[model samples]
Target: MGNFATLQPGGRPLVRFYLAFMLWFVGRAIQAAALVDPNVRKEFNDLPDDFSFSLGAAFNGPQMAIGKDSNGKVKYLGKNSNIVPQVKITIKSMEALFLLFTFRESTPVANSRERMTVEGNLSHACACVRILDIVQVYLLPKPIAKLAIKRYPKWSLKKHTINRLLINLRAIIGF
Candidate 1:
């Protein structure tokens, strides 16, 4: 209902907990998406194998890093801020970020709502959004995904089934 950043009840412990949980949840989805999506791998292929990106709420909200391995498979880098991310998606508040994670808002929609901004290379931001879209395909059903993305792709049935199985398998097994 309101910005969690402004609330700060109990010194913001709830906000921190929510941010931490979302970071892990979204990080897993990103890893699964990157493992199976050709385009995601293609996007990272041009970058170094150790390349990483981040998404978080601005003003000290939770942030998580998504890094690529030598094979371009995405890995979760934990909540540590030791390694600087090459690109960062900064949502203006925890409320906005929660909306995005819940699929009530998409990246483009959030940007239009002035709830999020991207800092660093613009192309990387675009690439990261694409990666998020791939994650949505695996995580959300068609009707719900329609709400989360500007465009819900119309892939063939065979392709969808195969991709879904592979993505879900890796995501569940943590491989």
Candidate 2:
């Protein structure tokens, strides 16, 4: 009988690490955007005061959580902890997460491609997606951000520049 071999199953550690970092930044950026942008603030405010969310790769992968704090301000809750978020957005696998973090696919695109899934209230998930789109616009450069979102906003110079800078600063400083 001829001999046959099977390849080993595997995981992408580097991709997982990258995803963890990106998720951390994105969580912080969302919180910061709510503080710096009136539109973002309004969107967040519309959510239930206790609203929280988690985004990450599926099956015990690196994840980040964000939600409103006691003062009703948005806060990055760090990695998943005791708090159970109202919405959880999970990417199907490490490859899909890599694609997402690398900007190879936008959130909407990934959803349409069936590479991602959401659990919880549909309306809240829609709001979270909108928040993410706006945060991505601030966090990434114009050309790349354009690729990351469905429709780019027509922002005034002050908003695109000043608010972007403030959001980046706040997110980085853990404000």
Scored by TM-score, the top model is 2
lDDT of 1 by residue, 1-175 (tens): 5655565354467757877886776687678766677766677786677778898987788889988877766788877768788888889988888788777888788989999888788887888888888677767788888888899887778547887887767766777
Count clashing residue pairs per candidate: 0, 0
Candidate 2 lDDT over residue span 11-73, tens digit each = 778878888899999999998998899988988888998889888888788899988876779
- Give the CA lDDT, 0 to 100, for residue 76 in model 1: 83
User: Could you tell me every candidate's TM-score relative to the true structure?
Assistant: 0.83, 0.94
User: Which candidate comes out best when scored by lDDT?
Assistant: 2
Scored by Cα lDDT, where does model 1 land?
0.78
Residue pairs clashing, model 1: none
| lDDT over C-alpha atoms for residue 161 of model 1 | 88
Screening candidate 2 with a backbone cut-off below 3 angstroms (N, C-alpha, C), the clashing residue pairs are none
The alpha-carbon root-mean-square deviation between model 2 and the true structure, to one decimal in Å, is 1.5
The C-alpha stretches of model 2 lying farther than 4 A from their native spots are 1-7
Cα TM-score of candidate 1: 0.83
The 0-to-1 C-alpha lDDT of every candidate, in the order given, reads 0.78, 0.88
